[model samples]
Target: MEQAEIQAHQSTYEKEIKDQLDIPLETLWQDAPIEPNWGIKKNSDGKNTFWFWFGFKGHLAVTTKSQYITSRLMTSANLSDSKVATPLLKKVEDQFPEHFTTAILDAGHDYEPIYRQLQGDQMGAVIPYNVRNEPLMP
Candidate 1:
């Protein structure tokens, strides 16, 4: 493709990534309770990025050994992933008491409260550092 064509394609790709859907609301039909929400994406360097979309997010608790999903929660895309972690874990814990000993999550769930909740339940947390969440020096 020509340079202009490449640039145009890149622009279109970026636009699509930013706004996943552009359908007319009047023409759209939905049976489930869906909502528009923004989500974060970590780059290769672990830097925080963002995107907007209209849909639901599926939070699940899976077993490492059996690779089976024990608990699941579906929420609007606007819901923070961190917010769902504890509840999902609680569901699993309540459903299958003492079945899991650890919770492995990504940097998106690097919140301190999540850590405390897991610790309170005697569960280990393995979440990486999310620098974006760190407090800046004065």
Candidate 2:
């Protein structure tokens, strides 16, 4: 192809990618509804613990056994971990559909909707949240 044609093709490809990856302006600037788990607090032992103030929170998906980080998502700190779990999992699923079969998350990701969605997708979930006083079986 001619140099001009090649340049035109490259420009078109770049535009297409930019369009696909674009986020809405409102969503980009939206703040979390509440303050994050930051600031200093005194523990029961009278020791002060200081948590750094970060505007955003990072969620990471790692291999269970290997501990290799596979995917990550960043959101405003005010957003709960449960709120972003599905979106982060969906991104990972899109990237590696055939690799992951189960997801193990903490209590913060113990939302029923997330569990149901994972179940619908034939994915196993291991979330330990104490809705009742019963112990969760492994």
Candidate 3:
């Protein structure tokens, strides 16, 4: 087979894998719920030092170089950041499909499924989870 043919085969395989794992955006939105009455308080030295008195916590998607927030998702504080990644990403894709070239995420957003989905779209994912105890480059 020619090099172009091999590349096409590889691309087709990746698309199939992505399709199998993709979750509909509507489903994702329905699954994520907001708690209006939720609150948190942390006490230190006999005084309240930190408080989330009401409302859900927010997950923000910002441009790495610009530091501008592009999108936001509200979720219960109890939810992990990783869980919100997909839906938030879908929203971003819908709004600016051609603008995003890379996704720079923290350790909290490190997950295999997320990485796979991002890469499948030709988006660079910079998540350092250290699953194999290997040192990450600086």
Candidate 4:
């Protein structure tokens, strides 16, 4: 692609993200609506990997040493896991301030805002990269 084309694409993408972020976070999960969760079928090649189920997804923040849930949130399966991290962490922080020092999470929680929140809370975030959403090198 030409330089102009790349710049235009980036500009459009940034605008779309800003528009999405403008929506109130609370409204994002005000209702428990059935949504699709995409899953890959086992023993299938990349071409036929897609499958889904309509349901809700449960997210939990647990105490590492005690194995007890400190916070939880449920949302439509379609919701991105990254979207719930900050809220869930906030809840944990409110209830158990200074109780934990690190958050271990999967690649789905690999988002800039989530990391920023963790940093602001004086906590460490151990999350892998979501290749589809981020550049390989950071």
Pairs of residues clashing in candidate 4: none
Tens digits of lDDT, candidate 3, 73-120: 887665556677777788788778868989988765666777876775
Q: RMSD to the native, candidate 4?
A: 6.9
C-alpha lDDT (0 to 100) for residue 130 of candidate 4:
69
Model 2, 34-131: lDDT tens per residue?
A: 33544232342445764456566777889988998887766556455665565556667667785788999976566666777577556899988745
Q: Which candidate should be chosen as best, given lDDT against the real structure? A: 3
Report the poorest 10 consecutive residues by lDDT, candidate 3.
11-20
Compared with the true structure, all predictions reach lDDT values of 0.63, 0.59, 0.68, 0.65
Stretches of candidate 2 exceeding 4 Å from the true structure:
1-52, 132-138
RMSD of each: 13.8, 14.9, 12.0, 6.9
By lDDT, the candidates rank as: 3, 4, 1, 2
Model 4 alpha-carbon miss at residue 72, Å: 0.7
lDDT of 4: 0.65
Q: What is the TM-score of each candidate against the true structure?
A: 0.65, 0.56, 0.63, 0.65
lDDT of 4 by residue, 12-101 (tens): 112223222333435433532345554333333436556575667788999889999898887666665666776677667767788789
- Residue 5, candidate 2: C-alpha displacement in angstroms: 50
